[model samples]
Target: MTPLHLTATALASAVGAGSAATLDALRQERSSLAPCDFEEIAIGGQIGRVRGLEQVELPAGFGEYDCRNNRLAWLALQQDGFIEAVRGAIGRHGAGRIAVVLGTSTSGILSAETAYRARDPATGLLPDWFRYDGSYDLFSLSRFVADRLGVTGPAMTVSTACASSARACLDASHLIASGVVDAAVVGGADSLCGLTLRGFDSLDLISPERCRPFDAARRGISIGEAAGFALLEREPLREGGVALLGIGASTDGYHMSSPQPDGIGAEQAMRRALASATLDAADIHHVNLHGTGTRANDLMEARAVNRLFGSDVPCASTKGWTGHCMGSSGIVEALIASLCIENDLLPACHGLETRDPEIALDLERHNRTARIDRVMSNSFGFGGVNVSLVIGRPAR
Candidate 1:
């Protein structure tokens, strides 16, 4: 796979509104989990809830796209001059030459929940203002963003659970390689809602406290909301940018929710990513793990890492700082890995208080300085959808 240059990136999560705040929280070794205050689903467990989405205003004509999910996407797009970068790309490559690919699991389903509650007593009709396609459609996020960004090229949505956005990046790279587009806006956005919260609770995957990814006492996941975006071009818009070197995707079909206990699927994904990148596992400097804080997930991922990279790879999970942003996590964590490459910093595994002796992973306990030239991020989703991405400093 020819590398795709990451020209620009931006994110908004519970840690703060922009990448600068995210970097600060990482530098301070902070965890952003807080008590569950999302809607009326009175459930136990902390969540990575992004603040101020209620205050964000959508574009005047794009009122139908009003929802927590799209608001977060808009907020993220406004950060770090990402919009300007996209505009510049548009100027260089005509609007028809850029593609828009986004991922989301719960795209404004909260709007549907709200409208369902407001149904008329006799007819059971939702509020007149509520349009299912406008807010609740699975493709609404991608459609709204492409319209707002004035991207007229190919546009698509991905909804492969937690691996959604990371897979979107892979899809974008293929589009560029196939000469279908010159550049792509790849990212994802998911917001807090009662549906996802109660659903996880029903699955018994919600933790009562902040999630500890690989701790011996680890229990379950802490749900979070976030939006992240990156602009990927076939060539570097400027020198010294991060590049997506490889992407590996596979499905284990083991269980609907639980990962393959032995991590065969996870192992295959990482190995395939290495093969796609045309590099050995020894070339990877750091890894951003899909450490969801669940016992089964952490164990399986650690086993996979051991089978491949051994104990030498510095590995950590940033979910403690942003929570598990569900589908959006893929893009969020990928951008964080890019930030690490740019700054040469390896963030500590935030929630691991006690190491799990069964796993041989070299968990990062604190921020460390390293001559990191290449990094990897793994996004393994429910229903056995797994993806691994290799990122590196642009080759000189």
Candidate 2:
């Protein structure tokens, strides 16, 4: 795959908005994971819920598309003058030539969940004002963003579990390289709701406390909500920006929720990403593990990295800070890795108090300085969907 420049970026997660806030949290080892208070649910586990989404007011004419998910997206776009940067891209490449691609496992199903509670008692029908297509559908997020951004080019959404947004980046690169579009808006948004919490709880995947990824005492995952956006182009539009050096995606046909116990599929994705970048495992300076604080995920990923990189590459799971943003985990972790390159800092595994002896991961124990030029972030999802992204500073 041709490398594409990440011209501009924005992020809104449990830590805060924009790259500066996120970087500060990482450097200070500050985590945003808190007890689950979302929607007043009695669900257990700490979540990286974004603060103040309820106060965000949508722009005029976008009210109909309003929901927690889209609201979070709007908040993210307002960060670091990201919308202005995107508008400039629109001016350079006509709206019709700029595509939009976003990823999300749960679009705005929260709105539907609310609507269901308000259904007509006699008719057993949802409210007349309820719009399922606008809020609940997977494609709704992309459509809403395209219209809001005034982009007339092809618009689509990716929903391959947790690997969704990272795959969106790959798809966007393909569109640009194929001349289907000159540039693309790529990101993802996932908001917390009752359904997801209950589902995960029923599956016994919800942790009762803050998640400790790669820790010997690790138990389960902590659900979170976040939205991030990146503008991608063939050339850099801004100085000192990051680029998508390589992308690798694979499916091992493994268990529904359990990874290939041996990590073969994860290994392939990382290897292919390095190959696409025209580099080797030795070239990568840092790694962002898909350490969801689950036993199976951490163990499998540890085996995969040990097999490929030999535990030489410094790595950690930022899920302790952001609590696994699920489908949006791809872009969020990518941005975190980009911060690592730009700042030359390796963040500590926030909540990992004790390393799991079984998983031979060279987890970062503290915030430290390093010469980081190339980094890989892994995003492996349920049902064997795996994606590895290689991000690096552009060659001189």
Candidate 3:
């Protein structure tokens, strides 16, 4: 795989907006999780909801696209002067040469849920004001982002659940490598919606208290919402930025919403990623495990990493800080990887008071400084979809 430089990055989550805010929160070990209070949903699990979405308004002509999800995307684009950096990419590559590929599971279903609730009392028909195509459609995110950036190249939306956005980066890498586009905007945004909440609750995966990944007493996931993006080009627009060294994706036909018990698929993804980067297991400075605080998920990932890197590499999950950001988990953690490379900071596993004795991988015990130049970040989505990315500082 051809390495693509990450020109600029942005993040919006419950902690705050922009990559700087995320960095500050991680440095201070601040977590934004709180008791569930989203939209009158009676679920007891904690959630990481953005601070202010109701007050956020779309630019004039995009009112039809108004929804919590799109609003989150808009907020992310404004972060870290990311929109300006994208405009600069447009200037360099031309709008027609830059593609937009975003990932999300429930793009704007919140809007659809609202519309469904307001159906006519007798007719059972939705109101005329409802714009499913604009808000709820899966393509809304890519289209809105492309329109906002004035980019006219290929636009795609990936919906493979949690692995969505991380896979978006891999797809963008292909587009750039195949000459389909000169540059690509890759990431995802997911907002809190009743459908996601209720569905997960039905599956008995919602943790009542805050999530504690890799902890012996860890229960389950605390649902969260977030938006994160990165711009990828053949080379750095300027100099000295992180780049995607390699990406590997795989599928486990084993189950619909559960990972394979043995984690063979997860190990395969990491091995392939290392091979793709022309590196070895010893080169990975740290790992960002897909530790969702669930028993099955954490155990499977621990086995996979223990098999691949043994106890040499330190690992942790940021879900405890941001909660599980669903479709946005990939890019959120990818950005965290970039931060690790850029700042040499490895975060402690938040809420992890006791380590699981069954897990052999070295989970972070404290916030410490390390020579973190390359990171292997893993994202394992529901239904056995998994992606592993090797991100590091660009070569001199």
Candidate 4:
């Protein structure tokens, strides 16, 4: 399969906006997880809440999409000529020639929750201010983003738990390669909401202390919210950013909520990605692991890494710095991997301390400065959905 080139990528998360701030935090090994102070349902552990969404003014016409999720998407698109890149792709490919594919688990549910809370007692109905019809639909998010960007091509949403955005990347690549579209606006966005917080709380997966991925005493995961966008084209536009070498996806058919104990599915995903990239496991220099800090998840992923890449590849998970941004995790982490290729840096695992005795891998305890040429990012979600994306610097 011909690799689909990624022209540009952008991210907005708790670590900060743009790649510079995110890479800075990664270099410093900073953990941004702090106690959640939101009044609605304050669960302990760090969250990647954007610091100043209140101060950001929306464009005059986009006031209706004012939730934190869309707000962050708007803010991220404003960075480093990202908007221009999308416009350029549109101009080159024509408005109808591009497709839009987004991955999101919680799309506009926060607005629905707000409306549900603001029901008028006198009328027994939602207030007019909160009665917007598209507040709770998942497709609404895709439509909102497509309409906002003037992208008239096929628009679809993928909601396969945490692997959603990663799957979006794979779908976009196929669309562009198959002559379905000339370019694709591929990414995802998710927001914090009371239902998610309480649901995780009910499952007892909310960690009180800061999340410690791969730690010997790792407990559970911390929730987060983010929005990431990447402009992908079939061919390079001038100096292209990085090439999406391959994407591999699988489902374990194991437990609905837990991964296979021996990491069989995860290993298959990584192996498939490497094979699709036409590279050996030894060719990968670094991996952005899906270290959610949960005991089961970390252990399974560690075993998979050991089986596939041995213990030589320096690996780390950025969840400690950005928290687990759920559906957007794949895209956010993919952006980090792209940045690693762009800057020749390997980010440290923010919260890992003592490596688990059961897992054998060269886990980076501190920031490592090296020329990273090839990177793989893993995103595994509930229901055994697993996705692995391999990205590399364009060959000169």
Scored against the true structure, residue 50 in model 2 reaches a CA lDDT of 92
lDDT of 1 by residue, 111-196 (tens): 99999999999999999988787788988999898999888999898999999999899899889989999999999999999889
Q: What TM-score does structure 2 among the candidates reach?
A: 0.98
Order the numbered candidates by lDDT, best leading. Answer: 1, 3, 2, 4
| Alpha-carbon shift of residue 139 in model 2 (angstroms) | 1.5
Candidate lDDT scores, in order, read 0.91, 0.89, 0.90, 0.83
Q: lDDT tens digits, residues 1-396, model 2?
A: 677898889989999889999998988888999999888899878988899899998899887788899999988888988888889999999999999999998899999999999999999999987888887788889998899888999999999888889989888888988899999999898888887788888888888989989999998899888899888988887678789999998897968888998999999999989988898899898999989998888999999999999977899899999998988999999999999999989888878888999988788668879979998999998779999999998776
How much does candidate 3 score in TM-score?
0.98
lDDT (Cα, 0-100) at 343 in candidate 1:
83
What's the TM-score of each model vs. the native?
0.98, 0.98, 0.98, 0.95
Candidates 1 and 4, the one with greater lDDT: 1
